[model samples]
Structures are given as structure tokens and as C-alpha cells.
Target: MKALPSSSGSSGEKEASSSLVIALGSSLGATCPSEPPMKARRSLEPVLLAPWGSCLLALGAPASRPTRKSDSFLWPFGMTTALNRGCWHKSLAMMATAIKLAVRALVEVEVRRKSERLALSEAVAELGIRDVRAIGLAHRLVLETLKRLNLLDEVAKAALAGEGSLEDLGARARAFLRLFAYRAVVEGASRRELASFVLSAREALGKGTLRPIERALGRCTTLSLDDVLASRSGDERLALELCVPTWLLRLLCRDLGRQVAIGLLKASLVQAPSYVRVNTLRGEEGEILASLEQEGIVLEPVEGLRHVYKVVEAGKPIILTDAYKEGLVYPQDKASCLAVEVANPRPGQVVLDVCAAPGAKTTYMAQLMGNRGLIISIDFSRRRLGAWRKLVARMGVKVAFPILADARFQLPTRLRADVVLLDLPCTSTGAFAKTPSAKWRLGPRSPKNMAKVQARILRASAEHVKPGGVLIYTTCSLLVEENERVVEDFLRANPDFELERPEPFLGLPGLRGLSKAQRLYPHIHECDGYFIAKLRRES
Candidate 1:
């Protein structure tokens, strides 16, 4: 699981970022007993599903102001003042109001609009007013809850529904109630709990004269009720019920078979497996696992890939561990690990990792080479490469070097390598569960545009590959144009390169005449939906 890129923030900005966290804890307010008994967390099985669930809940809770006695003296004086002077319930109301405003700003505010600028800053400022950690926890819950149940759109829609809309009638209750029902109907939340949540929300919001708010709540509730009732039986069709744009779902269903399409959609709702790749350069797998266990982290060994493990109990930020900081392990998907294997980098092999930023596979290849081979890793962004360098150094990888250059263009110097790994950029449809933002932001034109880009990269990289060397193409995408279709077109134009079978374990075969290429689906594989093809240049 690669970390998503986030916006840059300052020390002050980091403090301001707690607005959402503060909002998340507004329900309990100051009445939160000092040292309230922590509820027993759910079992951390199936790719750290329980920890991931807790993460989301934490994100949804409001942030809290720092207590005077707490460590970390950087806590804002204004926040301390708020805590010391205000009534706890008054703080709760303020937190709720701030969250509502922040959510609206997040969902509806446009980046280019000046009118939204103030709202965005206001939201950020709220974070500094309370413990931002609680907000982060709540946000995590919102994401995990939706992902695990394939209910992101349903929840988002309910959250944003307007007054007088069908969704509004049902959502008019308190915020938590509406959210609970959305989870219940769309994500398999229990009915009794959902009912209780609904009642609580109603009590919080009260039967007010705010018609727009009422309408919004009503529409949200009604839609959620319909979805829950419709999916009561857990039929694949019912379970895969998505609130996606009709055209998108139609296109996806057309490309993939009905059952497989539904499976892909449903799988996106399931929490992604928290897979970690041990840094063989630092220590063996046993040593890394032992270190992790010492910190209360548990791992489930994946069947085929010995280096990979499904994180069972991920405590706090696992990346913060000294082992991780020292580059002992990295979080990577099994499907991604397989891509490098398909490339088959050897000890003395010279390879090219195009668009290799944050260098997960590049380092993996370096480790496979025992740090003896040369790997030219190229990407256009220096900022991205900085992160790659950080990881490379941490992992003790010496052979791979980063090149800041466009992937579409040929390498500046004339050189060929034994293997060329092209993990081309695509629409990333296969990663919907982990990144719901892509679902809403990506357009239909993405596949065609990305196909052209992959073609250019393949053609350029082919010129550099030594005769008899392999050129492996891969994408974190399931779309045919970016996967099978791109390969088909490339093979037709470049007759000298033939698609070759991947070694060790050959996954499900490809489409059309490219059966040698492998395609993996998240639902079936319990990994990211991915595609890989190994092509060798004729000697």
C-alpha cells in the first residue's frame, strides 16, 4: 500500500489541520472522563481490518484541546485558553458547528474559487483549537467504513444531500445517526445499532424549523433506507450496489463480465490488505517480523510471496518504527511485488524503472540484485524522487539511482539494459477501495490518454533494452486499454518483441492474442487489481 501524496503544511499549518479531528470528538466534549476505559478493539485479522476500522472511527471523531498537564509543550496557547475558560458543552457545540462548516468546505468548496478560500482556512484553524488526532481518527473511520462496505458514495451522498431532495428526508436527524444508517444499509452495519444512531442524531439536531437542513437529512435517510432494504439478502448484485454515476458503472460492466464486474465493485468496498515487503537488504524476513512483534505488530504470511505479510495489528503509525525509518520494510501490495518478479532482475542485470517515484519496486529490484546491479529509476518530479531517495537510502539499496525526467521521453543517454520495468501511470481503476477520490475525479478519456502514454513509454524504453532483454509493462489498473489493448497494439507495431510468460507463478492469462500477459483482480486475488506482461526483444 503506497502512501498517497498530501499537501505540504507548516508547523502552524499542521496545528490548523486539526479542525476535522476536533469536530470528530464533539459528541463526547469535555465530559469525556479523564482516562475513559478504551473499548476493546475488534480483532485485527484479514489485512489489519480491525485497526483500519478503528482508524476510520478516529478520523470521524472531533479533536480535543490539549490539557495543561500534557507533554508536548507546542500545544497552542489559544487552545489551552479555550479549554480552561469555556464550558465543556459549549465547546462541544462550537466543535460541531466547526465540523459542519469544515465538511461543507471540503465537499463543496472549489480550489479555484476565492469565495471558498476563507472557509478552507477557517477549517484549518479549527484543527489548532483541539486535539487534531481525534479528527484524524474519525476521518480514517469514514474512509475505512466506506471502503470495507463499498458504501463511499452512499455515505457521501447522504452527507451532502440537500433539503427537499429524496435523500434529505432521511438524513435530517443528527449527523451520527445519518452516518450510521448509511453504514448499516450500505456497509452491513447492524439494524439495532443503526436505529439507535438515528434516534441520537434526531435528538441532537432536534425537530427544527430549518427546512433546508431537514430536507437534506430526509433525503439522506430515505436513500440510505432504500439501499439497506434492497441489499438485505446480500445477493452479489445487491451487495455490489454502488452509488456511482450510471454511465461509469455501465461502462465498467460492459468491459468486465457481470459477475467479475460486480466482484470488482464489491471488492472495492472491502478494506484493502495492509501488505508489507521486508527489506531484505537490511535483514531477513524472520528478523523483521520479530522486530515488528516486539512493537505489538502482528503479521499474517501471504501464501506465495514470502517477503510479503498482511498486517494484523498495526499499532499507531507503523512507519514511525525505527525499523521502518531504517528501511527494514515497506508497505507494498502483493500484486506490485509480482510486477518486479515478472521483470526478473538478476544480480548483474541493468534495469530501468520508468516513472519510479517513491521507489518501492526499484528498491525491491535492488534487493533482488543484492545491490550489485545498476537500476536507472526515472520520473519527472524531483520532489517525488526526494521521497524515493529517502526510501532507497533507508532500505540500504545502493544500485538504484533516481533520474528526474519524463517517462514518455527516451533516456537522454544512449544505453540499454537487461530488463526494463514500465509501471505506467493509468486511471488506477483497480485501486478504488484504497482511493475513492479517483472514482469521482477520473474521466472516461483517461484510458485512451493513458494508453497513448504507455505506448510512447514502451516504444522509447524498447530502444534502450539490450537484445534478448525483457521489457515488463505493468499498471495498477484493470482497464483493458491500459492493460491488454495497449499490449496488443504495441505487439502489432513492434514485431520483434514477443510477449513472454512470467516465471515462478504465472497468474491468470491475458486477453486476445496476449494470453502471456497476466491480469489480477482484487476480489479474487485479495490484492490490488493489476496487470503485467513480460516482453523479450529478439536477439
Candidate 2:
């Protein structure tokens, strides 16, 4: 929760700035050509409020005149606060109480009826917020918290015993759950504040309070807000521990076994390490590391992850560093960087990154090829591609050509590629730590649905690969259905493509009969849960 220092007028700013950039730049010396000034895209803030109207404003989105389409986008930006002259929304201090309530309510409902997406969306709509992104964020927070607490069914029964239908109680539960989550998880507000936050919740969910809930709070050691946060053994206690829901824990046990699930849950609670890939197209790794050292950013080498550095300290957002602004380095996950290594892009190789957007892998592959080959990056989303363009511009990627197209359909007539990287979308179970909300939105049916879509995307991408070229399939999900199982299904249907071992060895070997496929997990490898396999076209 520490605020970033402004670069304006600090006496030591100049010296600190250069030192920081140098430390960052040293990692990019092997790939990039020259050091450049830093420019950063601001990350969305930690606290978000539901908007009063449809327009959604990003936590740090600069103040400006309202637009006509604002109503349609409300759920994404969140509801702004009325108290601070439009200056303040919710702050990060209220987490303890908000998270606990949100989890308690969400888990209770999900365990009973399931499938509440539409009801939640409608309730958020009434709140006049249109920003789907913020809605998604808030929804995820409640869902993840519930899953962590093992009270999904308990909370649902408490929230909806009388409502009798998903459509009837869904919105009411979501609104109430959001308030409770905000008070517990994000605001860390105490029981008294928790009572206040649930004012709206009380009106919508008028069921009699559970006697257990009453006794649990009555036994609190003190009435003070901090005491409520520190109280043990209620649903709130579970929120503080941040454990995965008992059901999810059981599901994980069924798949990866109890030991691995416990290990992963422990890992999920740990703060994700910050890692960035030095743009090899800009300079060599040695020179980049030295340059970054001169700039004062502290970094440590990650074992087995080439061109990746973990940030220990920083003077400014790395994006503002001259090295980053000039496309000398890009922030990417270490596991994702490994996928390109498996692709083995040669200098003249023609590569295709299907589903490429926000361009991390696209740019990384271009750098791997020394900017000498053609790389066509295709995605169905134009807006996402526009964002990718911004990254390409910032990262100084020159060889990649981004196209707007769906991977489930036929590729363009001239779409053949030497290396096709099919990083198709999946359940994203591996990214639970980064995206805590998916646990709520997901179900047993998620993998089956996602696998079907992935199979289509994979087949389309595979068709575009040139004879004897390599096709790399990957996902950020650990599910066997989404990972090895999908690959097995594809392999059975396509005889010309043979599975190949991953290069540079970033992940552990895969499971079942697809052991040649590479899989990385946060619990085991301390990286995003990822699955990657290389397939060679025998021709």
C-alpha cells in the first residue's frame, strides 16, 4: 500500500532515476540496442467503488468530461463516491470486514443453486455501473473470498433460504455480498462499520439472521472495530486466513492430490514475485543488467528463466524508466517467457501467435527472432489489439504484424507460419492468485466448455503452420481437461502433428501419458500455473 514517489522536484531525483534505470537496463543489454527514457501505463488501483450511474471510471482514470457511452460502461469503472467531491472512492483500509462478509454470502449461494452470473449483472446494472471490468473485479473478489472460506453452501442458504430462485435472489445476494466484501476484504472495516456497509444488504436480504452468526459476534472479546477484525473462528476468521473453500480444496485434491492442493493454497497466499523480461531486441542481457544497476533498480536473477529479472526495489514505476519506455524491457510472467523458448523461433522463422493481445508474447517472440523474421499476431478483439499496438510502440517491436481475426475461423489466405504459438484461452485456474475471482465464476462445466473452444482455436492455428514447422500449444490452466487431455484429443485426431519436449526447461514434466508436455504451478514452481507443449508437423 506504499504510494509511489513523484519525480517532480526531489533533490536526489536525478541520481535516483538514473540508478534505477541502469539496474533495469543491465538485463536488456543482450537484446536491445540503446537505453531509452521510461514511460509507464498506470495500473488500476487497489480500491474500486461502484458508480452511481452507468459510466465506469478506472481507479486512476484521469478526470475528464463525461461521454455519451458512459452508461454502457459503468460496471467496469465502478461507482464513484459522493462524499469526496468526486475525489475519493473506497480506500484500501476496509479490507478485513468487507472480504469476510462478501465471502460468507457468496459461498452460501454458490454452493446451493450455482449459476448466478445474470442475477449479479442485473443487480450491478441497477447500481448504475456499466464497467464490466470493475464488475468482474468486484464479483471475483467476493467469489474468491467465499471459496477461500469453505462456507459457500452455508452462506448461500443464509442469503437465499426464502428467495427460492436464482433470478429472485441473485442480484440481492450480489449487492449484499459486494457490500460485505468491501467492508471485510478491501476496507478492513470492523463489525460496527460492517453493520453500516450492509444497510443496503439488509433491505434486499431480509431473512432472519442465523443464531450461530449472532452468537459468534456476541462472544467477541471487545466491541472495538479492530477487535472484530481480530476475532477468531467465524466466517470472518476464514477470510483472514485466506484459505481456499473446502469444496475447491477437495476438487484440487481429486486432481492434484491433497499434498499439492495444500501446497498451492499456501503459495497462492504468498505475494506474487515481480518479474520482467528484458527486451533482447534492444541489447544483450549483460549490458541490460548493468544499465539497470546504474539506474538504481534492485533485481535478482531467476534461476532457469533467461532474460527474466525479479524486482527487489524501485524508484518509480519501471515503465517510466528510460529502458522500459524505449522498449528495452517488458513485464511478463517467467512461465509465459518459457513458452517462446519451446517454440525456438529462428532468425528467419515465420511465427504466428494466435489469440495474441496486449502483445507480450508477440513482442517477446519478435525479440527472440532478432526482429529479422515476420511474426503475425492475431486476436479477435480489435480493442485489445489497439492496446497491443500501444505496447508494440512502447516496446520498440518492429517485426510483428498484428491482425484482428478470430482463431476459431479460417485464417487469412497467406497465413502459413513456421512456428504457430497457440496460447488459447482456458479456465485460467492457474492464475487464481492473480485473478482471485475466477474461482467463483468457474464450475465443473468450465473445463469442458473451455476445452471445446480451445480445440477449435488449436485446430485453426495448427492448419496455418507450414509443413515440418513447429506448433506450440499452451494455456494458463492446470486442469488436465484443459491441458494434457485437450492435447491428447487433438493428437489423436491429427496424425501429422507429434508432441515435442519443451526447450530451456522452465516447468515440470506434464501428467498422464502426455508427460512430454510442460506444466508449471505456483505451488510447485512458484510461477503462474501454466501448461505448454510443442508439436512438430512431420509432413
Which window of 10 residues has the lowest lDDT sum in candidate 2? 1-10
Give the Cα error of residue 201 in candidate 2, in Å: 15
Q: State each model's CA lDDT, in order.
A: 0.58, 0.57
TM-score against native, each model: 0.69, 0.63
Q: Give the C-alpha lDDT of model 2.
A: 0.57
Task: Kindly list the per-residue Cα lDDT of model 2 for residues 481-536, writing each as its tens digit.
Answer: 87788889999999999998778776778888777888888877767888899999
Which candidate ranks first by lDDT, i.e. highest? 1
Off by more than 4 A, model 2: 1-248, 283-287, 294-296
Please report the candidate that would top TM-score against the real structure.
1
Candidate 1 backbone overlaps, count: 51
